[model samples]
Target: MKKNILYLSIAVIIGLIGGYLIFGNSSDSSNQKITEVHDHSEDSTNEMWTCSMHPQIMQQEPGDCPICGMELIPAEASSEGLLANQIQMTENAMALANIETTIVGNLMEGNDDGVISLSGKIATNEENNAIQASYFDGRLEKLNVSFEGQVVKRGQLLATIYSPNLVAAQQELITATSLKQSQPALYKAVRNKLKLWKLSASQIDNIESTGEVRENFPLYATVSGTVAMVMAAEGDYLKQGQPILKVSNLNSVWAEFDAYENQISQFKKGQKIKVATSAYPKKEFDAVISFIDPVLNSSTRTVTVRSTLKNNENLFKPGMFVSGKIKGTAQSAEESLNIPASAVLWTGERSLVYVKPNPNRPVFEMREVTVGLRNGDNFTVVSGLENGEEIVTNGTFTVDAAAQLQGKKSMMNKSGEKTMTGHEGHLGMQGDSENKSDAISTMKMKLPMAFQTAFQAALKPYFKMGDAFVASDASQVSALAKTVLAKMKAIEVGGLGKMEKSHLSKSIAMLDAISSSSDLEKQRAQLVVLNENTVALAMNIKSPTETLYVQKCPMANGNKGAIWLSTEKEIKNPYYGDDMLTCGSVIDSLK
Candidate 1:
């Protein structure tokens, strides 16, 4: 009985030990799996973040962009599945950019009828123009037409002139009439002489019958038209064959449209045209093409197509703008592929379009397309696209901007050059080295104290303008620019030498360019040029009472770099303003 109890105990203890080892190992394996799953969750949450404006910046966690200071968003997914020239945009980005797409199949199917649109202006018909000239040399006594655009009728009295020669001729005619039977030849000669002065036969006969010599001769208009110009005023002396006024019959006018070289083939003499004008939107003018200019205007790259319209109501006036549409038969209406003008992105000589590779994804690839004729709002695609392919139409520039940011093949950067880092401190101060020579030369040059005072006074408004740019106040910048222009003009250059005056003149010109611009970006761009000229001027004749810091920004003017003058050593970049408030460095100091 004792041996049986002991064996049972031993067996129970062995079973308990085996159970403990099995359960303990199983619990440890389960905990290890849970820890591995938790670590994966943490890794998934560590997605990279980046800025949309400054795409080069990357961060491990969400934060503001270091350069633009904009809130960073999740970085774009790895571009492993994208083509070298393709980019993937999120749906939210597409909505923000207003990007729209359309299938490239039969876009012009119903609309392809070979209708050419043209833009031109109304002009006076040169054929209906006439000039009224004085028939005899005399001094004006009475004038009928007072101003241009006065309506005149044929044989109407235009002016009355007093002439000693006409009086002598009238006296000769009266004397000759007395001896008509004895001297018929002399009488005929005197009558013919009076006819040369445009005198009426009745006037000559009355002078002969009454034996009176008239001193004043009345001039009559030969043509009925509106006076276009009045060359002579009342009491003005006139000479024979001198133009007194110009008249034009507005019963007919010309609608001249410019045709580009490629469009010249579609136009021909006697082609029918329909014209409309903004002045009379409801009315349509119909006419046949009267003439097509044989010579092309090299400067305008256009040829003039003229059509004469009957202006019975005189509605069409010279210099009024008009649009025309030329109706023609299409040579291949079924084979045409046309896209909207907004879809095409032109850079220098290349035309680009963002083509959607897959209808399911937001992946777009930059494509170079061959373009043909330009219809009203569409362009005919010559090649490079196939049917059923989708393409971006609106917001093409936005896509190009993104492509440029991605360092992909874009309209401006066809070679896929890497984007330049324009951050203030990313590159170790690039422009300082180039301006060192200028700074050395400038430090050596000196000007008279009076000239320096005037120059410094002229720069006060400019400094204010820089501050306005820093504040991003466009209106304030415009006002300050004008004030700067005024101060620059008020600068006395009489004390300046020839070279100094020339330099000052160039600087003033650059200032004028900036002051005239209403666009802030354009003003900023002009400011870059103005800074260059101003720096050169300052180098030669810097202010003595104040210290000027010449600052440079590598990110300005499309990353080509720009410089400006500031009074402080700390940089307040005007080009970028709040977007990149501290995006520049002081290149040199001027005193």
Candidate 2:
């Protein structure tokens, strides 16, 4: 019994040792697997999703961006190696945003000269203009050149005049011819007097031979030209030296460009200029600077630069808009890093650009650059860039927009400042405090049916003026404003309440102010005030016939905000015209 117990104890000890070895290894493997699974779950939870457009939005799960309503994408992990101002983007995002880059090189490399751009209009050359006047007082019997723009040539019969004084003088000449044998000096004096009246020697001799006085004298054009103006008509009496018509020689025309105060230094008399006109877009004409007006137009803040161009083909007409470019000398050629104008973002005085640090990664950083001269489509880099560096030439705004959303350094915001959370940021409330002014007053009083009808009638011309402003037609705007003012004045305010009368009177005063000024910018400024009153009036009247949209442009009135009434919901910004034609939103819709 002692020997059997010893064998059983040895076998049990061996079995226990094998079981411990196998189970210990298995437990270690199971713990290792659990740790790996835990790490993966933590990483997944930490991953963030953001919108490509509105990068400010960050969420744990895939969703849509609240701002732009775009799908959320996996937010790129922040690389510790990147600068604080730098941002990394995915290749797919860059492609979607159409981000493009160009290698910095000699933008004016091949060109030996620099160029100065100019804008102006073709004008009648003053040197070639002529005024046709009558030499003596007479009743105009016939005017062959009846209208402006009539082409006349030298020695062409322009008109016939019946002058009693001329007839008496001709009769005196005939009587003197009969007395020539007795009084030679008197006859010579009479013949010379007729010669002074532009009568040919042959005509005097014929009158003497025929013994008759001509009933009327024919006038001829002294020079070849196009009639600019007709000052006199048939049967009209003109005094001596009175202008009959104004003519301009169309063989050549003047191209007068307005150079801003800052750009006057770039222009010099006798410089060669290459001019192109919208009327003849494919054709280019060459001209030399003839004169520069010493006096600057105070209102326009520009000096007139004049160039004479040959108009033998009559290609250039007066008032035709033209653009010119003056080539610069080799020394004047800009010798600096030049980038495309689209690459730079201008906000107040600050100019910003995006620089890519890594060529392999789609990463860009907002960099402030000092700019020098701007020529055509390029800007000379005075500082802040190096040669051969790649830059975002196109879709720069998109990159800056993304940077702004990320709360990184951007064009509008110099520092990485966090924006307001909800309505404030969405409504662009972070600018000048003056922009916070309410657009309209709360004085709402229903107007009489007569006043409403008249006010509605006045709106036609007002909207026409707005369209003129959108077209950038200053003269048209002024004319339309005048019409609106007239209609406003003609409005019958009888039987209207005191509040309605007050609103109508205020609108009339504003319309008068708008009409009194021909300056488009000044008119637009007044239109802002007019718009506020009109909004109040619309609120009071509530035209039953049409729907009006009260649109607000945040960039107008020096960014203090301006409102205008539009018939359509789509924005047609009149304040900035084509510069920011689609820059506003419908703040209120009324019927």
Candidate 3:
């Protein structure tokens, strides 16, 4: 009996030990799973997501871009190993944003003409200006020169002046002439005194011959010019050497151009310039740089560049708008480099440009550049850029936005400061759900009613395609996409605005992408972009022919969320047709 009790006890002890070993591990695993769940929830709350194309979009969770419909990316700071000023952009983001780059080439190599255009106006040549003054004190009796701008020739009759002193001098001359037989020296002196009064030899001889003193004396013009100013009025008393008329020789004029301080080096005296004017746009006049003012204009921050032009045909007029083109004197490739002005971002004193160091891939780094003279669309890079480098010329703002999101040196964040989750800085949609509700609020243009009508008229086939996608028929979707693309293209854009046209063209690109794909999911992905443009267009319509409901599926687009327009209020998500058929909600309505 003792041995039997001991065997039972040993068996029970082993069973208890085995049972404890099995159930304890299972319980610890359950506890570990709970812990992991709690940790994952914390991470989800902490991590932030943002769109690569539209950096302004910030959400607490991963989702599609509200503005551009691109996939959201982790809005984390770039690695410390990378350059602080460098930014990394996905290939898809670059393509979708239409970011284009230009290869920086030698300014002289690319531009053979090497001409800089300058805006200026025609002015009177001060060197050729002359003032007509009275030789003696007098009162104007008769004014012959009628008005300003009257053409006058040398030795032409200007006006008649009545001078008391001239009448006395004429009487003295007559008296001296009467005693000429007795006093020959006195007669010669009297004639010399009349000559000193600007009287011609014939007039003095006539006075002596007639023996009569004239009350009024005739004044003649000494220089040929146009009357610019009539200084004295008729019958007004005038002092000796007082101006009668201000005359300007209009045969020659000055082409005065405003040159910025940076452009001063490009100009020098005697440089050839081709001047053109709006008055005679078909003709160009040759001019030479006569002078460059040493002083700068404080108010305008410019210097005066004067060029002499001949106006024999009277084509050039004072105060007329003119443009001048000067050929670059130093055309060698070594002198300097040029870049598109659009590529540069100007800060108060600093200028910046995004440079792609690697030609094969889309890797960009911010480079602070020192820019000089601006020649129309291009700028001279005095420093901070090299030849054969590629720079972002178009979509510069988008690139800077990417840089700011990535915590790199950007136009808005030049110090490479890390953005605060990108939510506070950018006025972004807060969460995934709210972003869907605000997706259609991208931007609306004031389109013409005619364009809006035509745009709505073309949506019939597109609406059918949406229904086809919801039915999960890939073939039907592709076929209808072609029709939609054609219909959208066929719409007349007689009064469409530029922004509206850009949206239409971009939507066409999206449709082309959708029509060429045979896969349903791919078509749906492209449709997101098309819907973005379409919804914006619909929002501009005051009375759309067909009402549209902007429906969104939070579980679609890789669980990132995607939106589409539907005629029905019911949620029928085309993104995940039949799989999660009613997995969306109506976020907006357009009528």
Best by TM-score: 1
Every model's TM-score: 0.64, 0.61, 0.56
**Order of candidates by lDDT, top first?**
3, 2, 1
TM-score preference between candidates 1 and 3, better one? 1
As for candidate 3, its clashing pairs are: none
Q: Model 1 misses residue 102 by how many Å? A: 2.3
**Which regions of candidate 1 fall more than 4 Å away from where they truly are?**
1-72, 109-112, 328-330, 420-591
RMSD of every prediction: 13.7, 13.2, 19.8
Q: If both were scored by TM-score, which would come out higher, candidate 1 or candidate 2? A: 1
lDDT of 2 by residue, 122-217 (tens): 899889999989888799999999998899999899999998888898899889988999999999999888787777788789888998887788
On TM-score, the stronger of 2 and 3 is 2
Residue-wise lDDT of candidate 3 within 1-591, one digit each (tens)? 999999999999999999989999899999999999999987875587777556766688887676546678766443444577777776766766678898888434556456787767788988999998888889998889979989999999999999999999999998987799999999898888878777788989899889888898999888999888899889899898899999999999999987777788888999999998757769898878999999986544569999999888888878776778898565533567888766876543467899988787667888999987777557888899888888998767668767776677765455777543222332233346443345334454678777777677668888888889889886677667766776776676667764466567657756755654556876786787577667767767788766788777767655555677778998887887788889988767877
lDDT of 1 by residue, 1-591 (tens): 999999999999999999989998899989999999999887776668765544556688887654434467776776778888999877765764468998786567666367777767788888999988887788989889979879999999998888888888888888888899999999999999878877788878889889877777888998998888898987888888888889999999999987767777778888899998768879888889999999987644569999999998989888776778886544554576778766876543566889999998988999999977766666778898877889998667557667777889876566887543222112212223334322212313346777777778878878899999899776567557756766766666665653355446546655544543446886786677577657766756544568888887867866646788888898889998989999987767767
Which has the higher lDDT value, candidate number 2 or candidate number 3? Answer: 3
Model 3: C-alpha RMSD to truth? Answer: 19.8
